[model samples]
Target: MKTDKKKIIVSVTNDLVSDNRVHKVCTTLYSMGFEVLLVGRILPHSSEVKRQYSTKRFQLLFKKGPCFYAEYNFRLFLYLLFAKYDILLSNDLDSLTGNFVASQLRNKPLVYDSHEYFIEVPELVHRPKIQSIWLWLEQKILPKIQYAYTVCQSIADVYNKEYGTDFKIVRNLPLKQNYKPAEKQSDEKIILYQGALNIGRGLEQAIKAMNNIDGVKLVIAGDGDIREQLHDLVLQEKLHDKIQFAGRLPLEELAKLTATADLGLSIEEDLGLNYRFALPNKLFDYIQSQVPVLVTNLPEMAAIVKKYDVGEITDSLEPKQLADKFREALFNEKKRKVWKEKLPFAAKELVWEKEEKVIQEIFKGITR
Candidate 1:
C-alpha cells in the first residue's frame, strides 16, 4: 500500500501544541495529498501535540540562548539531510538555514514562510552582533528560496524589496466556523488579551490601564518569557482583582473564551519592524468570534479595524489613553453594536478557506 505522494517536511522553533497557523497549514497540505511531517523541538515544559499529520519533536540538551539555536539547527540539518522529503518548508528565519542547506544538498525545493521580520525582533534590538548574524543568514538564504510566503503584505514587501524575491501573502486568518455569540456572564465586562505574553506586546500598559478602569476584568490567555514579570506587575499594581492570567489555552478553548469577552485587545507597541507590521491571529479570532477589538494604530492592524469598523485604534500606548479607549469601547453601546454587526462579514472574508487557495497554487507551482 505504498502510494506515491510527495512528502513535505515543515520546521518551526516552537512546541507544536498551540501553533494554530502551522496546524492549519499542515492540515491543508495533508488534504491536498502531500504526506506532511511537521517538525519542532521539545522543551522541558512542552505539552503533547495531537495532530492529523505526522510530527517529530527533537529533545535537545540546551533549550534557550545561543546553544539552543545552534544545537537545534545542527540536529535539524542532520535530520533533514537523512530524512525523506520532497519539499522543505521552513517556518521562519530561525529554521531556514538547516532547511535551505538540506534542500540544496538534496536538490529539493525549499519553501520559506517568514512569520515576521526576524532581524527586527525586540529581543535582537539591543544585541547588535547577534542581530547581524541573523541578518547575514537571512541575506544568504533568502536569494535561494524559490517558493516563499509570509503572514502579511507589509512583511512580504520588506522581504521582496530587501532580497529581490517575490513572497506571497498568506495571512493567519481563523478557520470558518458556525459561530454563535456567547452570552455575557455578568455586568462586569471582560477585556481579553490572547497571545504570547512577550515584551513589546503592550501587556504592561494594558495591565496598568486596568487600574484606571473599573467594573472590568482583564484576562490574559497565553504564556511566554515575560509571564512571571507580568504576574509580578499585576501584584505590584494591586490589580489582582482586576487582572487574571489564563495561561495558554488551546485554540478551541481560546475561541470559546474570546466569544465570552466584551473586548479583545491587540495593543502591540511599535518597538520593531515586526511589531509595527503585525496583524496578529488573535485579531482574526476576535473578529470570527464577533467580539469588538481595541488595537494600536499600526498600519496593518489599523487598516483592517478602520476598513471593517471593528473597533477603535489608538496612536498612543499611554495607560490613561488605553483606559479611556477601553471605557469607550465597553460603555459605548451604539458603537459596539455597529462593530458587532460588521463582524460576520469580516469573519466571512477573513478565513482559511480563502487563503488556502493561494497556498495550494504555490505548492502546485512548486510541484510542477
Candidate 2:
C-alpha cells in the first residue's frame, strides 16, 4: 500500500517542540511519509534550538501577563492564514478553535488529539465557569471533528460514551526500544521521579520518604507549578543532600538518569478523573530503562506493575504508608531483581511499535 505522502500541520497550544505527545506523533507520521509542520511558540530569548527532525517549526511571539490567551489565539490565527497543510492535527481543546477555522478555510480534514480529559485538568477543577466553557467547546468541536485520537483507553471510552463520537487510542509510548537494565548501585540508591510536579503527584510524600531512608537519594526531574513548594519542603526537612531536584533535564539526559536508577517513581494522587486513570510516560520510561517502578495503586499504573511484577504499589494515601512503601521498595534487592528480569518482556510488548498499527489504521481510514 502506498501511504499518503502529504503535508500535515499540527497546531498545539503549548510548546509542541517540547511536548512528548506531539514529538511522538510527529515523528511517527514523518516515518509514515507525512511532512509534519509543528506550529507553536518558542520561549522568550531561548536559544536552545533542536536541529534534526522533519518538523518545520513556526515561532509565535511570547505573550506576557493575564491576557496571554488573546495573544496566543491571534498568533495562531495568523499562522493558519499563511501555512498550507493537507491535514491539521489539533493537540487539545485550546488549539481546536484555530484548527476548526483553518480547516473551514482550507477545506482540510482536522484531527483532534486529546492528551487528557481536558475538563479534568487541575487548573480547571476549581474554576467552574472556565471549565463549563471549555467543556461546551469540547462538546461542540469534538463531534464535528472528522478524525480524533486520545492517549489512553479510559479517555477514548469517555469521549465515545459522552459525545457518541468515535476516535482512535494512541498510547503515549516512546519510540526508543532498548535501554540499560536495572542493576544495584553501590554508592547511592537512587529513587527517580520524572514528570510534571503537579499538585496531586505526592512529591511531598516522596520528600518525607527520603527522610526515612538512609544512604538513598530522591531524584526529582521535571518542573511545574508545585516546584517551588517542593524545593521549600526539601529545605524545611533539611534533606538538601537526600532530595535533589534536577528540574527539566532534556530527554537524552533524562533517560540516562532514569537508566541509572535503583527504582522509578510515579505517585500521582487520586484527585479527579485524569489522575484516577493516569497512564504516565514515566512508567514506560522506567520499563524501557528496565528499572522497577514504585507507583500508586491506580488502575492504569497497577495494571502495568501487576502484569510485569515490577516493584511495589502504595494502595494507601497516607504519607507514612507511602514512606513505608518507599522504604520496602528501596531496601529490597531480591524483589527488585525479579522485577528487573521481567522488564525486557514488558518493555518489548508495551512500546510505541505495538501502538503504531492502530494509529496507522486511523490515518488509513481518514485517507480512504
lDDT of each: 0.91, 0.78
Residue 99 CA error for candidate 1 (Å)? 0.4
lDDT of 1 by residue, 81-106 (tens): 89988998999988888888888899
Q: After superposition, how far is residue 346 of candidate 1 from its true place, in Å?
A: 0.4
The CA lDDT at 110 in model 2 is: 83
Taking every candidate in turn, the Cα RMSD to the unseen true structure, in Å, is 1.6, 2.2
Cα lDDT, model 1, residue 252: 81
Model 1 off-target regions past 4 Å? 1-3
lDDT of 2 by residue, 269-314 (tens): 8778888778888888888887788888888888878988977988
- Candidate topping TM-score: 1
Clashes of 2: 0
Q: What is the TM-score of each candidate against the true structure?
A: 0.98, 0.93
Give the lDDT of residue 241 in candidate 1. 97
- What are the runs in model 2 whose C-alpha is more than 4 Å off? 1-4, 45-47, 51-66, 182-185
